[model samples]
Target: MDRVPQVEFNPMAGLRPAGASFTVFAELREQYDWFRSTVGQGFWVLTRYERILEALNDPERFSSSAITVLDPEPAYRWIPEMLDPPEHTAWRRLLRPHFTPASAAAMEERIREHCRELVDGLAGKGGCDFVADFATRFPTVVFLEMMGLPTERLATFLEWEDTILHRPYEPGRATGRRKALAAVVGCFRELIADRRAEPRDDLVSAALAWRMDGEPVAEDDLLSLCLLLFLAGLDTVTAQLAYMFWHLAGHPADRDRLASDPAAVPTAVEEFLRAHAITVTGRKVTRDGEFHGCPMKAGDMVLLPLNSATRDPAAFPEPERVDLGRHPNRHLAFGAGPHRCLGAHLARLELRIAVEEWHRRIPAYEPDPDRPALEHAAQVLGLDTLPLRWPA
Candidate 1:
């Protein structure tokens, strides 16, 4: 750890309540630039903009197979997301048509209506838990629509998702994860069978009919494909939304500006994303290499917190500031390289509509005094409760 500054670099440290990530990011960059951490069985950490991009921009050097420092038990690779190059390319190509920009755009009016309904429930009420009221429900229901899952069973899907992503992986919760994953796999297996027997106008049915390299997908591969889609489509959006509202509740000026001009939301959303970036996914070193003067060995985990790229002073002036209209914004919030997020288009549309609709209904809101917003950070940074108040 040559010239490395004294900083708390624990992976679990950032996974707790309150916001201290940017502080650590700033401190580390100013001192050591980049270094190694003991967390996740000793990972090589990169935080600077250019250094992070250097790895992401070149997949041949850094492998996406183990896309997280946290290694899942039984060595499960999550389809295209955790696969590299040729294998990833084929699966993604088969699934790409289902999530194109046009597909996301087609669902805009429907998403807007859902946003209005969510706001209508909270409108004129003195306050409500923003996370429970809107953030989680809107995305969950939309995911249900896309998957053709039963809307009335939203609680079941939400429960499975929460347990898998949020409850943690201690010995006590090991059974919890098993139960949830088993339940999900069981349900989706039935859904896939139904789709093959009788096609429907949904992602599952569409994927069933798709071929790659001139062959139908294997059953195990199909299950893995749907599993990743279920987790990806439902989880990240809610966390990002919770963080966005947390930002809006704190910054009255930014909130006011967005509320005043709906057109400014797209750019504002980008800035919000940059400032509040949260995922801490990882990649493995493919071979012996040196990045920014840091040495690494084959099979070493390289932690890439895409959000930290926002704090890179070299890439952004006043890197901490949230400029709603910052142009040429090259934030890696959706990520970089070939294995980037497949649902970016859908995610952007949801955020824009959610922000626009929420502000139109309740423009002036802040953190509730009696019950402050609670922060819960982990592999995914989010808040379990975001209580917001407006004029009664």
Candidate 2:
């Protein structure tokens, strides 16, 4: 067997011609075996499937304290995502119960109701931008509802999330984004203050009243938890839904299979997640380590390309093709280990409901080839705008 070749991380190496719908970063995972890039002065890049997983599982050896590659000035310094070990675990524990299967299952009727209304509004329209009209809005609303925020304030949540994820490094962008996010946090602060006065049946109220180690979660902790939930739940899953629908529209046969068997929705959701897995989680080596015969020194950065890993031939056969009925499918789209996505159950539920409801209404949906879709390339890879049309 030929060993996979390694390449230096040259960001420009993968640039496509102007106006290209897709970029080389998406393709480089398959065409080039591995690439080395510096995250900071000392950090290194691990761009392969096997090594990425190994690093994710061994958080003791590879710490997630460096989740973002951008400089850590501004308020970005304190988000829980940049913390390691016991600290990260503590924050995660506080937020986990709210997303439990029981909790997520309870939201199904509400999710379906939201989906029905969104789709019904555009029911007979000849075409629409799936990303804005449905994908982006749906998850934002669901997350706000979960967090006990007023549904009218969802735009505030979306603006803040986009800033944290996309414009962390840009001063102008960060300023506007942070201001809007701070406003929402201010609202939460008041809500927390109010909940203290009059508690209610919501995550915020529950979190306010709840205790950890005999101390109620502080205001900052409550705000940080809400921030994490907004970033995790809204950004990733919305993009996942857009990508799934894009693929389904292109593959009519798969759409037919799903439309014919609504029961296959769960299986199809799993397959879509596996096939279009987004986000490249980063970790830094805590100590010198060896993975797949490659020496990784302390402070080195590793990129876990979930999409590439899902398609690894060693893991899944015919890794590129969409197999809705794929059995025994185990992919790391949601990631693995302690940092595995906390909202995985809710994300899957959202995807299943979105697809089932979509096909039930528009079985023959297809993308508008004339106006190609757009994808956001950050830590997470996802569709920005997916335009589609069907017979009205």
Candidate 3:
């Protein structure tokens, strides 16, 4: 394979306008097939739909050892996420039953109940910072309950979530990331110890009983898995919710479609997931190779910007249009191939319930003209603030 001419581009270092991440991705896809970003350690990016899918499916070459480009050579592994092949396969098998459609179905009622409780409180408020007041809290409650953690400390968990995920990377700004990660790990370590002693009927306890290759899963590995869940479970849905609502708030016709039909909410969820695909996961190059002309050496990081792939014009006709009834929406919102999101069913369930329940109560709303949605791009694209208003 011959090395190809590559442009140096940085996707992570920027302030994105409201819902402009998708626009930025569109331009990137039009301009460059791939580029080397010197954002963190430096990584190769695959922007086209076909190539991104190829890399995701071909994990043997594009290893999951380093899922984030920022920390290309991470000191710690997050269990299944950073594991490759058989190890990743085993973890997925263990986790599959817990996140199946039936499992997600079982939680729908509880999810709706939680969604309504939160939405009901906001019904009279006229307007609120939806990100703070609703988006973050809704999934955090459900996640805590699933993990068998005390929901009473919801505020504290939210704080830790903000610190670990929302804090942007700055040069010499390791303190916040390290401190937040330590706090989460320390908290999980204690939880693992407690679950080991008590052995309750929660996900943690279920994980405790897992065996890999006829051996009990190690305590350290358990902590790592829990850490992954903590980061993934709490953050992903919140980010999705932020973007979904932000879209709906601005586009009332889309909002009305969900409110009027009710049945359309499910498909609308899919469309929103497609249009506003948030996650930007990466892979580590396994050996010396060239992917479609770009040279990649062993230990080099490769970014799979899922958002860019989903909106590729080649894949989706009129890619930018948010068609609520978009059939055959094979978007990589939950990713593709061996490492597709385990909590995908749960995420869909949560998003469906959230849209259904919220619009049922607060039907008509729009983004506050004065204070706009604050958008950013990192490992995930999300709104830090979404001020929305309706008639009191």
Candidate 4:
């Protein structure tokens, strides 16, 4: 464990055209197995499929304490996502029942109905900003219903989402981010209070009964978990939907296949997820050791861009192209090992339903050439604007 190569890489660079992030990662994957990024306190980038997988699977060696490279030494934690091993296990156990395939299945028809309504409303518009009109709203409605939040506050939630996650982490946005975090924390505090005063048949009420180590979950822990759910629930699916539509809008053959043969949407969803894996998370090295031919030390941040694994030629044949029929597609899009996404089942169902419903209604569409879809690369890769056009 000695000298390490350094690269002037910034994962949180400003917005770029669609697929630019992937292209950058692809070049990095080709050249470097792992390199120390000279961005935000300096972190190692594990660029290969096997290296990233090894780090993700070995949570003991690679802690989830600070799941983002920018904030490797975060002042706070976000419940299950930032927790590791026993603590994370308990939280996952308590929350698993709510996000199981059965739970997602139970809400299938309702999800489909809502997705259809959103699609149908815009079917006649000839063109639309899919990110604003459908992508964000569809998941926000479902998440609000699940958490028992008021639908009337959808606009406010979107505003907070943008400020908290979508913005660049420059000094200019520092105050706005702090204020947004406080607002979210304040909102969750009120929700936790209400749920305690009177329980309801919702996820918030269910959290009141969660126990860790045979004792009631602490108030601070509940707030942390709620904060995690708030960001994760409202944010990830919206990004997934935008990326999926971005792909479908650009690739008509895949879109027509899903539209004509509805049964193909499921596998297509998996492929789209694999190709457009949207999260680029990080892990803090817990102890000093060498890994994947790279020198390591305790407290080092290792970046795990999920797309790097999903798009690795070593893992998937012809990784660049989207093959809807690809099988044994064990991509780390939802992540791997203990920290795998808790909402995976629900997300898959929602994406499947949204694809099915949208293509069924508006079978032919493409990205609006005048207004390109903008993508931001950070902890979570996201689409800012997706202008789509189709014949009325």
Top TM-score: which candidate number? 4
lDDT of each: 0.80, 0.73, 0.87, 0.88
Candidate 3 lDDT over 1-392, as tens digits, reads 23443556555645567777777778778988987765566778889999999999998999999887777777789989999998899999998989999998998888899999999999999999998999889998999999988899888877887777667766577787788788888988888889989988689989999998999999889889988999898889999999999888878888888888888888889999999999988899989977888888999988898989999999999989999999999999999899999999999999888888888899999999999788877787888899999987
Model 2 error, position 172 (Å) = 9.9
Candidate 1 worst ten-residue window by lDDT:
5-14
Arrange candidates by TM-score, descending: 4, 3, 1, 2
The clash count of every prediction, one per candidate, is 1, 0, 0, 0
**Each prediction's TM-score versus the true structure:** 0.94, 0.88, 0.96, 0.97
> Can you write out model 2's per-residue Cα lDDT over 254-335, one digit (the tens) per residue?
9999988999899889998888888766676677756665566776666666777777776788877889999888888998
Q: How far in Å is the alpha carbon of 205 misplaced in model 2?
A: 1.1
lDDT of 1 at 326: 92
Quickly count the clashes in candidate 4: 0
For model 3, the superposed segments whose C-alpha errors exceed 4 Å read 1-8, 170-172
RMSD of each: 2.2, 3.8, 1.7, 1.4
